[model samples]
Target: MKAAVVSNAGPDWEIREVPTPTPGPGEVLVRVRACGLCHNDVLVGQKRFPFLGPGPIITGHEAAGEVVGLGADVRNRRIGDRVGVPWMQGSCGQCAYCATDTSLTGQTAMGCASPRTTGVTVQGGHAEYVVASASGTVLLPDGLSYEVAAPVLCAGYTAWSALTDAAPGPNERVAVVGLGGVGHMAVQYASACGLETLVVTGNPEKAGTARELGAANVVTSGTELAEIGGADVIIAVTPSASQASEALQGLRRGGHFVVSGIFPDGSLDLGPRSTFWARRQRISGSTHAGPARLAEALDLVASGRVTPMFELFSKDRIEEAVTELTRGTSRFRAVITY
Candidate 1:
């Protein structure tokens, strides 16, 4: 099988012929058709994730493929089933976090003592063939194509989960920080839910795009957002902690703020502890909520309520895809087609 193999840190990935993996017990071997490039893949390539080893890692968690082989104890999935491999590969079901509520089990990967994370703990879907736990894969809707389904596994899932985590009321306003891959989807989800959607982005060029994505209003900063009557729920999907903190000013009193982006540096300043308490603001972190939420995200895409904007790249052009992602030039998301 041909794969984009990472030899060392940085945006370096070489296409090489590697042995195809076979499905182990309770796992499945997928013939990857499309995989989305995420910022975390770049971070993994740069060795930023401490859980990652020295080198030669396949870093891609947003994979949409067809099952070619199934292992023992896999009754839920079968051969030729279209599935999506998410960031949270598998979790210890016996743990309190996972055993408590199946709906929130997807978050177990973050708190679980032992987690099988795709591209981090195990092999990723950057190659033509990848192994995944049968229980971890989500069935894709028939209406979604492999290229479109790929990004929904991660970016769309995260955005939808973050919006759910905020738990905004029916008449409340929702603000999305950033207009990147995840933020773009967040805006659509908020709009689809019939909530008043507001977008806060530093890029003025994205104002029109944000509105087109269902944002009722677009503001350049937190100040601008707050000046126009703050939102009841603010979902921050920007990688910059400082920018997220700045967006907090746009949250109305007794509002919810959900941080769904990965911030590598700088602490999240709460700004005066007294102000946080006085405002009665709530903060939460959300990731891949669970398979149920992932299914909901896929349904939204299948129903045409939410559409993902992405640029496609052939398997041989993996390097070019990563370059565009690192340079922040991708339309919204980048999918590597196998």
Candidate 2:
């Protein structure tokens, strides 16, 4: 099996022949057809994730493919099933969080004290073959292709989960603070829900694209967003916490602000304590909400209500994909096709 191996020395990726992974108990071996490249992959390659140690690693979590082998004790999934391997692989069901969570939607990785996170705590799906817990995989919709389903596993899931967490009212408006991979999908999801969607991006080049992606209006900054009466809900999908902090000014009184992007070393600066108190705004962080939300994300894509914009790369061109992603030049998302 060929995979993109990351070397921590150069923090670069190289295509190499690696041993194919086999399914363990309660797991399944998937022959990966497509995997989406995420910004976390770059951070992993740079050894920013301390748990990954200082060496080579496979860093992709948005894997979509077909199951080729099933392990003992796995009854939910079987060979030939088309599935998607998401970021939250599995969680200890006996933990305090899982034991108390009665939603029956499955515990999310963010809430789990000990989680089997793909590409972080275990092998990822950037390779031809990857192993995943049968219970953790989502069945891909009939009409969705592997390339389209790949990004939905993580990027799309995160965007939808953020929107869901905000719990917007029927007549509330939504403002997406970025026009990157996740923000682009957020706009479509908000629009699909019949909400007025506004996009806030610093890049002028993306104004036209944002409008095309269902954004009713495009603003360059939070000031511009506030000039037009502000939004009822704001979803920040940019990696910069500073940007997210600035976007908070666009949140209407008693509105919800959901942060879905990873900001490793950034902190949100609420300009003044009085402003936040007076507004009575709420702020929350969201990741992959749960398996149920992931299924919903995929359904939106399958139903053609939400379409992901991505650039495809072959297995051999993994380096090129990484370069484009790190340089912020990918069309929206980058999918590596096996």
Residue-wise C-alpha lDDT for candidate 1, range 135-252, written one tens digit per residue: 8899999978999999999999999999998889999999999999999999999999999999999889999999999999999887788899999999999988998999988889
Q: Candidate 1 — worst ten consecutive residues by lDDT sum?
A: 98-107
lDDT of each residue in 217-291, candidate 2, tens digit only: 999888889999999999999998888899998999999988887887787778765477678899888777788
TM-score of 2: 0.96
Quick one: how many clashes does candidate 2 have? 0
Model 2, residue 84: C-alpha shift (Å): 0.1
Off by over 4 Å in 2: 51-55, 102-107
Residue pairs clashing, model 2: none
What C-alpha lDDT do the candidate models reach, one value each? 0.89, 0.88
